[model samples]
Target: MQPTLTGRRIIQPPRSLLVRVRESVDFLARHSPARFAILVFTALILVWTLLLSLPISSHARSGTPLADALFTAVSVICVTGLSTVDMATHWSGFGNALIFIGVNIGGVGVLTLASILGLVVSRRLSLRARLMAASDSNASRIQAGPVNEGQAVRLGEVGNLLATVAFSALAIELIAAVVLLPRMLAHGYDLGHAVWYSFYYAAMAFTNTGFTPNAAGLTPFVHDYLFLGALMFAVIAGAIGFPVIFALVRLWRQPRRWSVHVKLTLFTFAVLLVAGTIMYIWLEFDNPRTFGDQNAFDTVFQSFFMSVMTRSGGFSTIDISDLHSSSLLVTDMLMFIGGGSASTAGGIKVTTLAVLFLAAFAEARGRTSMEAFGRRIPRDILRLAVSVVLWGATTVAVSSILLLHITKQSLDIVLFDVISAFATCGLSTGLTQDLPDSGVYVLAATMFMGRVGTVTLAAALAASTSRQLFRRPEERPIVG
Candidate 1:
């Protein structure tokens, strides 16, 4: 320490570089977790990209191209299964291991993962850290306005919620892996190959990422209903989000005690699942390329499987291109809605759709407030839902236009692939593999924005939130 001229006090030496960086990071984590999350995700993608680009990462002893490497990294980090190169053949053992690790990190979620890391470093979660973690469960916490405690995971339970997130993910993946190992072994794989592939599929299914380790993809086990059923179970568990899992674990026997969020998510998911299955069977039952050749039982089972995959599971037993245009449109809607919030799945989320529909129903009934299961929904949540939907639609629309122009592809195929990217759904019409570098970059951005979330991206980009002290003069606009 340096002494002052007057010798009354000693001046402290400047903080070291490492100390300064830590302080800056702490500030960001506390003040702007949304921005911090985006930063963390971007940094991880870059690191993975660098690792994937190395010669050892590929089958051949040559560095992968920048575009392919970056796209793969983004897809892995975003937990999106879309790939420009053949995922099973293009990468070597080292590259595949990197991918396996990346999906697990990404699957834990950006905000939740950041909170976990914060807890490890600090040995405790700060107030701001808890709030940030809660934001992952309930996005309404991200707003500058007053928070409705009723809508969020309680502050006191944030630690438990974090623990639930980690434990449930591991437990679910492990069970699925065990269920799959015997199936793989029965299919003529040796012990080593069976163990690795079984766990690989479990991670992919639980992460809702559709990357298949083998070049044959899921074709070898196409008729194995038991194997496919296990994958579906893992995918649904992952798509439901951690908060829902936490709630279900506590209130398993008492459906009435379930939170409004859990009820809506499960109700909406079930409805969509049934609706999608019906549509697929109705449209493609007679089509030879997809379901026509299958027996009645096989056709129904495949339709149900495809419906589940559209929930962001990404695995496909048949060629996506062979489906009717009408079926593609149906798939588009399902993909656009995506899965639950704070999940490995992407898009605007199932809760957003539920809120919008409830609003519409309430309006038609001449009710002032939206109510579900005896609880009234707040206006702020409705406003957030609207904003999320608009942002998601705009993103999908703009990306579709750009992709169509770049690839000169038909609107049907281009829109399907674009929504697949925007929703982080890996089921493609075989278009992703043929895209040029320019198109690849655009799709990658869509995947990043989708996986990071529309609301989160908006919150991260906002400079500040301004509060209005008073309301403006009341004015009425023309009705729809």
Candidate 2:
């Protein structure tokens, strides 16, 4: 039998003061997982915000403007595409590189990296043992699933999670760069400019932030395949949650078998994308500003891209502001939905909405099982899905009320803006530039909240683990 820690090892606390305090807090919690995720994100963002706000280099021509730096840094770290500053003109290469590092770190998440490292070090096997190790250890990226449908949802074994995140990001980014290279070369950019453009586009696309190193972005190459190709791939990849991507990859290797998560995510994503695309095409057919000049094929392409971009990936072929009301409204809905859970894209998340729909359908049919992807949606998952939706919507509504008070904007415009910030969607109705610092900070905070999620943030603040479901003790209820 394997020996378990029974003495000083079991009783000992973390050596570092910070860790010790954290451990004491964690010990008090019934569920530490959610709290831990939130804490990791909050702490990282805090450190990143500080680093960007400070001027590190002595030879800099001007000290980084605090607002611009903070805003840019937050955008990168949250992987939110919104930007207050012109990245190309304002920051030096050093600053841009720092921002890129923040983007890479934030896009994938710190906890994910730590989880990868933990998985490597522990030398663990057996699904249950691995999950316990992964979940209990802050380093474990995210405990994923209960493979068996009837069983309690266990934290998913890390499996290909790490490899899929790392390699898939790189491979896609590299391919995008390659696709963009020819057009960049043809666009009168010198060898240096071409290479730099490739690198820059790759970074911007992968991060799903619309910050462009080139002043023109893909606008200069609106008709060019190379430029469009990179943007197209990047946004699509970003829009498709990481979990689905990895799951799809695993399914490809084992063609006959696909996990429940993989099947559902892919199914839900396809339906949303196709539906969003059709809506855009239909809504914008009579409207000229969005896709009026383009031919049918090009129009379809542009609409598709815009639809995809709405859900957290911020790149757009045409200036998003030009879109007609109907198109913008559809895009807003897409943004509100966001991407899948355990994925890079933000908003309320696709999975939450998916599970919700499943639950609702089950209720309507008077069926006890919430069927999705031929698998019964577990009660725990359904509860989490509901919590995510409820918390996200409430937060967005409150944030919107405050933002409208400050901006004095129309309800439609303010709602769009608030949703954009909270979803980290970055599809603005052009209010970002005119906002006061307080307003900007409010939006920025919303973006941060959107990125890490409200539940996780609340858990971190309270130092309590969160469960998807719990029993309620009976009490006298107040009447409405």
Candidate 3:
């Protein structure tokens, strides 16, 4: 007890366990959102791993092995759909439900989910909290002191961003479910089963998960253009990124009002989608192993579907393994590029590629600044893009070599799986299922690292950057 200046006896508050725990949590919430996101996802994967390892989670007489269970958990948590086992036949209802839950959590993001929870619990997030969440969700880092830089998002705007992400996902998934349900029912699925399947595919499509509840996967829907159309719509909507969606929603009538980020994303996305579709059609049109057996309409439809899915949608209307060597090469490039920044899709992101090209274009034109849409792109952004590309390529290359050594698979197949894992795109050439336990672990680790690595590297670099207090003497190096 301590005497107070108020002439009364005062008792000091004791440091109890609850207070310590609260303090720790508060520190985590305030200090680093990126680190917190990683921790939360890691913890969730652990919980999922334990549940999936249980006998009830699998339909087989024996429970899932720890390695398989862990791999599945990581894949779902990372929203990467690659699986070492058949999700349909190997797991029971309980297991599927857990997977569904994991996919949803992984899709929306840990920081966004936590921010929503905080909103529910506290009614509103504090400025620091919003900044933390925004730090994790922002497609690119907003510089500290730039009023007209056009990259900074206000704290107030973050609330709207969070709402937009949740509402957009829910609305799109609901629409997809309604559209897909009736079609599935007409395809011979019973009413109740169709409902479940529709919603499952909706979630998978919008999240770019590529997971299928049906035992046959997307094989039965190969020729069903209407169903494939619905899935592609959901996939594109989700992969376009939240920033673009917000821009479009806000400036529905004024396209010119959209930010450069939105413009670049849309431009790049459209180019890739059209080019990929055409390339797939040109390469695989007459191949007996792929679309050659189908009618012209079916071939064109399947080619378009394949193009969309390759951009991190993870679905396919044709056998990926049957594609010609040239087609495989195209698929590799598309998967590597992935989707738009801050979207449900993975890979290095579309904006990075756009920025790299824009920079090169400016240099070729003898311009000092990277200008686009009448605005100059910042040097920091260019550095970030280069870092992301180099890091992503390094990851795929290293992982591919290791897998090739372990599985003794062809370089093409091994490289495909490795790139797929690194991009969080689940397209496979039949190698995922046949991989040994060690190879499975490698892919699982690759998925987790890919999911977290992209954002963490960007955020960490942005957070650690500081304005130099002094300048070094300038030197000119030799030109390339």
Tens digits of lDDT, candidate 3, 1-480? 453454575656667799898898778766666666677888999999999999999987579998899999998998888998898889998999999889888988888778877777888878876876676556453334443356534556888787788899999999999999988988999998999999999999998999999889888887676788899999999888877887788888998887888888899999999999899889988898888887888777788888899988998766789999899899999999999877888888888899999999988999888988888888778887898888888888888888999999899999988888888889999998988888888888889878886757456455554778999999999988
Per-residue CA lDDT of candidate 2, range 1-480, in tens? 344587656544437788788777555332455565566666776766666666551125466656666666677788887877666766666667777777777777665665556557775444533443344322112323343443212346354666566788788878888888887888889988898778777767776766777877767877775577667678778666665676577567873466566666667877898999999888886667667767998888877777777877777777666777767778878888887655667887666677788888998899988886566666776766677678788878888888889988877787887788788777677787677887788888888888877556654565323466878788997955
Candidate 2: where are CA atoms >4 Å away?
1-33, 54-60, 117-156, 253-256, 461-480
In order of listing, the candidates' clash counts read 0, 6, 0
- Cα lDDT computed for each candidate against the true fold: 0.91, 0.70, 0.84
All models, RMSD in angstroms = 1.6, 5.5, 2.6
Index of the highest-TM-score prediction = 1
List model 1 lDDT by residue over 1-480, tens digit each.
564554676677788899999999889877787788898899999999999999999999698999999999999999889999999989999999999999999999877977887887888988888988988877777768777756747777888889888889899999999999999999998999899999999999999999999889999999999999999999999998888898899889998988888889999999999999999999999999999999999999999999999999999999999999999999999999999987888878999999999999999999999999889998788999999999999999999999999999999999998899889888899899999999999999999999888998899899779987999889999997
Pairs with steric clashes in candidate 3? none
lDDT of 1 at 172: 94
Q: How high is each candidate's TM-score?
A: 0.97, 0.83, 0.94
